[model samples]
Target chain A: MKRTNEFAVGLAVLLALTVVVAGALWLSETDLNKQQVTAQARFRTVGGLGVGAPVTLRGVKVGRVEAIRLVANEWVETEFSLDRVVELPPKPAVISASASLFGEWSANIISYDPPPTDPNLREALAESDQVGGDAWPGATLPDIGQLTAQASRIAGDVGVVTQRISQAFDSTALKNMQQSVKDLAEISGRLVEFAGAQTTRIDRVSRNVATTSDAFAGVAQTFQGAVARLDTATSDNQLKDILNNGRASSADLRQAAGDLRSVMTAARENQASLIRVVQQADSLMTKIQRGNGTLGMLASDSTLYRETTATVIQFRELLTDIKANPKKYLKISVF
Target chain B: MSPPVASRIAARDGFVAHIGRRSLETARALADVRTWSPLLMGQMRRLGVDSVPIALFIAVFTGIVLSLLSSYIFTGAVPLYFVGALVGKTVMMELGPVLTGMALAGRVGASIAAELGTMKVTEQVDALETLAYDRNAYLVVPRVLAATLMFPVVTALAMGVGITSGWITAVNLLDLSTPEFFKGLKLFYQFKDIWFGLLKSASFGAAVALMGCLRGLDAKSGAQGVGQSTTRAVVLGCEAILVLDAFWALVLL
Candidate 1:
């Protein structure tokens, strides 16, 4: 009975221990039988990566970090184990440390397509071959410290730009722009008013031009009618008679003009003789008035003239008698 | 000084001497492992195998509470599945081993101290010494070995139960799926975390058992002494677990 009790207790304890250990192994995700391929990568810094950190392919975990060591006291050599079933390209890009959104860090693998062509990539690939054929050069993300520094620099640049912009928009420049806009608006208003006022004057000028053009058209019509009449008269033989009459009239007029010219010449010749005769007449009239001529004296001596007349009457009687007898006497003397 | 004060000071001195002597005797008992192996197995059955139900109950409820609180606190910024990771990490790294150690300190430590203290006060331990048997090896070593062996098992059990309960609660209440919960649970977990927990639990188990034995061995010949010893064992066992937990964290982590 005592042995049976001891056996039962031993069995129970063994069972409990086994259960506990198995549960722990399960919770810890231990898989001893999983096949792993060892690969190496080198970096300038590991960025706080420790052993047992996950190794992922495109953000999915496939293995863990096995070891890390310094190479030649300069480069960090990180050895990681990956599942053998996960195939890597001939050249793979390894990220030494990548942080998740929650800040957990891990190593990641990215496949290099078309094989890297850069010289640095070739050198890294060659170095990876020295550790293992599956190895590659690892890359690193900018850490929080670097990101914070970059952010601070960006913020400083933004602040400076804002300050410069603020300075550029000074009160004077803004006011000048506003004033220029207002001046343009006023000029536009004046131009509109000028155009409105000129419209009425333009209408009046157009009406006057229309009226003058109508008068000119009427004058042109009248001149055209006269020209038409003249043209019709020239086209007919009616102007020939008038032209002939004009020529005849011109000849007669020339003859008449010649006669009149002769008459005028004769008159001009007789003008001097007429002036002499008139002067003689004027002297006799003057002498007569002064009573110096014989005729003038005869009139003045009318009474004495009567007596002489009586004597002459007596001589006449005597001459009448002598004449009857004097012919015979004078005839004989002349022979 | 008054006479009563002088008496109190003398009493204090004597109690200090008694604790020191008991500690030395317990250290000497560690050398006799062969004689205590069978008793260690029996005690292991009692401490670990038999105590699974209560430990599981406490762990499950603790996990539920941790999940509830984490979801409530981190709901806005953190994803819902992170509650699983939070609960798993907390239970495995700190709570699982420490809480289990404390629970056992109350249950197993008080029981051991009360049994041994009653024996001491009744002169049963003296009778065993007079019979030419090694009382320390027969009595205290088994309890210490059993507790040390069982602590890792119990801690592992608690961790598994607690993490599972947290996963269940997150799935049911926080709208998290099973796969997402599991993904978050294993996001940053490591085998070293389990090892650290086991190591601390082993130390805590040994401390709890040793303190109980020492207190019982130093008990006076009265019912009051037995009761006082039991109380002191539970209190000192819990204190020792906390101190050792901090020490291991400092050294390992």
Candidate 2:
């Protein structure tokens, strides 16, 4: 090719590329197919909307931003093009989420399941087969920005709470709390004594939890198999639960993870009880070390001590009382 | 003969010289824009309007990929409304501007840099100066003004398209309701967002254009210098856009 021609060809290619991009953009925005079904969504507040922002469902490319209007003081109307085949769930959980942290705003239609529950599987027809515009909302939503922000806010509060808890643990003289700990120790000692006879009950509860864990593990194995099958289904996409397929397996795994986390949290909450149990065990060990009780003496001492100096002290106390008030103490009283 | 006085005097002289040169450049660019408003109309037709298809393809894929990525991790506290909103907000407020600016900078800005660099290496700039013509006004301003004007328009279009692509994914692949999807958009977005988005794009466009023009005008040495200027223009253009985008997002968005 001639030099000028080559340059011209390069420019032409670039130009063609741009034209194609623009045309494709226009088509996507307009939803050039079907042309009907005026897809509209109502917002409590349309923050900084113009007539030409894109409307999306679940972060996918669907249609263009046709227009936005203020219907009333409190309500705003946003109209856009939507491919007719894509069903909109009734009462779908809609939120302002972006595909990118810093990008255009799009509408995510969560769960998009239709009303009148329990559609037969073989009979589950497409919305195009019936009237469009409503379905069941998707699974539990993660509040993207709002959750992160609120989590951050909650984290700050938690930091304060955590510091206060640490301080409560650290607080000494001014707290009037050392006495409380002493009282707690006494109460705990009493509780150990009380539960001493109830070892059988604690054992039973532990056994029950074990049974439940085993049963849960069996169910979990089934879940893992189901997930493995799903992993195959998802294929190279490596879906990994991000897509939220609304399948039972996904729900099971999610719930199981949640349940497991909760169980761990509960265990953490009882950390003090666990520690006390360990401390009580150490005390029992110490008493045995000193040969102070039946177990301790049995472990160390061969003979039991009979009445000795301590017995004489009791006899002396009785005699001293007798001398202090003979009439009352001896009961002679001139009778 | 204290060193402090001499240093102060030199600093003042340098500042004055810098200001004088910059002002002269600015004046030349302004004059160029005035002289070649008509040519710009043609160049834009060839350059700006020409880049449509690839932009659309990119925009669509961007939406899809972003959607795939955005909901990568979900904490079940808040509902998924903001997942959609994240896509919207990022595309509208940040990525749309940044990507569009960078694309234009790489595609359009580098060309301006190379053209100006070549003119300088060959002393065409000096010839123009000798003819009592300001090179900035004749060569730099039209490209700057076109880019400053055209880029934001492209970005807005890209935003519009990106959201559309996101919708397709949401409806078909993600299986979200179209109505609820739009509802999230309606609820979250406002007019200020659009204004801020455009403002950022315009500023970014101007920065990239200016950087490209400056590098081209200031080119030294041979072919290596022209290549260096082009590369520097692209890098500086992108950097300036990003920094300015962040600043504008903070101040305006």
Candidate 3:
């Protein structure tokens, strides 16, 4: 009986010790991070998001996802909790990303710059914990989804703009450009010689401007006196009839004045655009004059110019040969 | 017959003989198990109550040593608590059960074989048969059943002691933070492991008991016969325990 009692006591002691040790361990782990607020963020596609996913703000971990579940409509939602002090910034952008491609996907949050324009909109959004309010036009987020969306939008816009550009520079435009280039080449080939003998041409341009100004002054003076004539003729029958008949001339003068004003307005509106084009043209002309770069060298260098001409001549001959000897060049092999 | 055919015939006969002896051994074990079941309750008390202090010391010291040494070895790679959990699991699930069976077999298997061998030489077994009682029942059932039932309880005791020893060792020798160790062990360990060890222990008990009783029954004539039976009981019992352990590992683990 004594031996049995002793053995039982020993067994009981061991059992109790084990239970106490195991129970204490269990309790410590249970109490760890208890009562923390677990918030879930639902998304259409988590993509690669998983449990134990880190929630980061500007590359700093704010919290971690504890669990993941598929909600209604097969959208995956992540359950996560954050520290008490981690106040979410306004216009928080959540994006799924990875430290590396093969690594786990973490939800990164980036905050917007402080703008007084967005808070009132955000205040309306604060009512629903599920999703925040409307995206402020001034407020922008850089979430991974937003980045992907932006990239796609940019690509689409580029594609559309490219199409528009292609349409704008159509076949007609290309033909016109080719004609213009031919005219320019002819003019440039002669310009060197013309520059050495352009004293007469310079004088002629100034003389034309002078003559046109003179004509305008003469017309203004004539019209001013003509109005006096009309005033006196209004009392006489023949003169009044002539005045009525001469209304076309007065209308023509008014039309000329209107045209001048419209032209001035158009010039004013196009001043900056005209300046930009002029600057680009001037730079191009300067490059041509200095004989720098491809275009300058192409125009000035005789060797390249001869090669190009020869190449075009050869291309013409090749095309002629293909057309003439159709059997040899365009033969279809049965095998 | 040709040499090849003759050898093949001999090999087949040897194989048949091996199969026959193994079948006999299995039949005897089945009979012994049936006897042990009726006397299980009576046997459990004797084995568990008889061996306590040694079981306690060995289990406690073994756990402590494992916990301390493993803490040093695994501290860099894993959390100390996980190490503690591994120690707990290893002790409770395997070491506790197997060690308890070995200890009991050494204590009880040799005794059964030696006692019966001596009684056979002294003609006590014959005398019992003359009184119209079953020798196998009275002699074998009580000791074999006691060892079998005791095996599991002793294992349970060892498992409990081993876990507690690891805790104490983690605190004192490994200098693991008490709370951290507890938390780590808690997170890593499952309750199911303890039950798995208990099951292994019961199986081991049956194996040890059956081997001991069978060897004793097969004892021959003279002092050398007694010695041979004793030696066979231990060697075969230990070997069978290892083989059964491997088989169970494949099946259960």
Candidate 4:
């Protein structure tokens, strides 16, 4: 073989070897020159994260995963290397998530001060922390497939809810709602009409009140004049004398009222007797009307009344005869 | 036994005998590394170093096409950076080794078979045998050893070129930046990916070179046989590559 050929072969082999080794190192982010800080995190799952998976801090590539192992049948502990320059937060936590729709995954180092917005992730972090290790807390974010499945389930639930709503708001419900609206409209119309009537009545009442107010004004004026006159009378000594007389008269009236009250008390006491007497009177009057007694015969018998009238007329005639022939009737005059 | 059964059994025996002979030849050739060691560099220069351009040619286009294709497939379904991932992974894991192997199989396998077959048909191999020369050592060992040693080197170069081509295409043709493409490229990268690919290519190299040598040794019918051996070597080499690729994946990955 020519020396050139051997040289070419050697060069190619050397270059190819370099490429393989260097490519692996570069892609793996195995920086031997720079210092790396090894840290660990425990997760319930790694979500397809494997060795050499990039470890990022706030979306910035900080390091790569070195190893992952299941510890104690409960959690997966991942040991990763971060650039020595990386300044970890006060409470650094790790979240493993599908880097893309593809099966790729990455671990993101974050602060645990503000917990993750996702409830499941927060709970996973809490659980990891509760495991009580020096390892940073870690949680697995759901992959695309899991999220898609959950979305499908949520869509199904929404579809069911929509179907139920459609069923509930059927034609019958629509008609009933329409009827209720119509009744409301009708009631509103009646209320409007009633309000109009009340408005008119109020206007009429206002006019009546205006007239009454005018009449009251006149009455007030007359009352004011009377008050003035009263004021004038109050200032006069004659008014005082009148007041004195009025007081005396009021006292007399009071005494009279007291006497009247005594009479009334006596009358109230004899009320039964008075009622009896009245009843006897009524009976007597009834007897008189029936001509059962002398007074009653006098009151009711025309024959007795005519007989008395005739006796009086005969006496009168006898007196006239005695005057003409006195001896005939005067014989018994002295007895 | 009936005549047909007897003939089938006879054919089976012949086949078994052929396999044994080929196995023996391969074993002897591999064992005679000392004899072939001086010739190894020349063969390496011819088979591995010479084949770099072609392997890289295949890999560049493969990477370019994969980038475009992955971009198309993963357009809205995933982030565009995943185009870098798909290109890197496909090239490193599958296309880089397989394509480089198959290309070298066509180039180097046919070359070996044609050269050796021509020599066999021209009685050069017999002449060597008559001179007490180990034909397997002279003919097979150096070629197989060179191929085995250098196929990985060629594949490694090809993988690098392939990924570089993909990165270029993504940055130029696709809406991707250097960091983004690299981020995706490194995202799913594993050291085992390179190891497995190199291992697979090494197996491919050995198979292709061995098949060519075995076919060349078994050549007949002169010029026609040489052509036939060349064709068969290329065909069988490709088939072996595929089968071995699958085997490695199943076993290693």
Candidate 1 chain A — worst ten consecutive residues by lDDT sum?
A126-135
Tell me chain A's TM-score in each of the predictions: 0.41, 0.33, 0.31, 0.48
What are the lDDT scores of the predictions, listed in order? 0.81, 0.66, 0.67, 0.90
Q: Return the TM-score for each candidate structure.
A: 0.64, 0.44, 0.44, 0.67
Measured by TM-score, the strongest candidate is 4
Stretches of model 3 off by over 4 angstroms after superposition: A1-335, B1-42
Q: Mind giving the per-residue lDDT tens digits that candidate 3 earns over B136-184?
A: 6666666655665566667777777887788888888775877766544
Instruction: Compose the digit string of candidate 2's lDDT tens values, residues A91-203.
Output: 45333344445334555554434432435211222221232343212111233566688999999999999998887676565466778788899999999898998999989
List model 1 lDDT by residue over B17-108, tens digit each.
87677667767877877767667767877776666677788899989999999989888888877887789789988999999999999988
Worst 10 residues of 3 chain A by lDDT: A133-142
Residue-wise lDDT of candidate 4 within B1-253, one digit each (tens)?
8999999999979956985787688677777767788888899999999999999999999989999999999888899988888888899889999999999999999999999999999999999999977998988888988999999999999999999999999999999999999978887778888888899999999999988988888789989999999999999899989999999988997
For model 4, residues A246-325, the per-residue Cα lDDT tens digits are: 99999999999999999999999899899999999999999999888898878877898799899999999988998999
Q: How many clashes (backbone atoms < 3 Å, residues ≥3 apart in a chain or on different chains) does model 2 have? A: 86
Model 2 regions more than 4 Å off: A1-335, B1-20, B27-34, B75-77
Q: Report the lDDT of model 4 for residue A170.
A: 91
Ten residues in a row with the worst lDDT in model 2 chain B? B73-82
Model 3 lDDT on a 0 to 1 scale: 0.67
- Residue-level error in angstroms, candidate 1, position A261: 99
lDDT of 1 by residue, A60-161 (tens): 888878788998747788888888898776577676554655656788887655534666645554455455543476656666766789999999999999
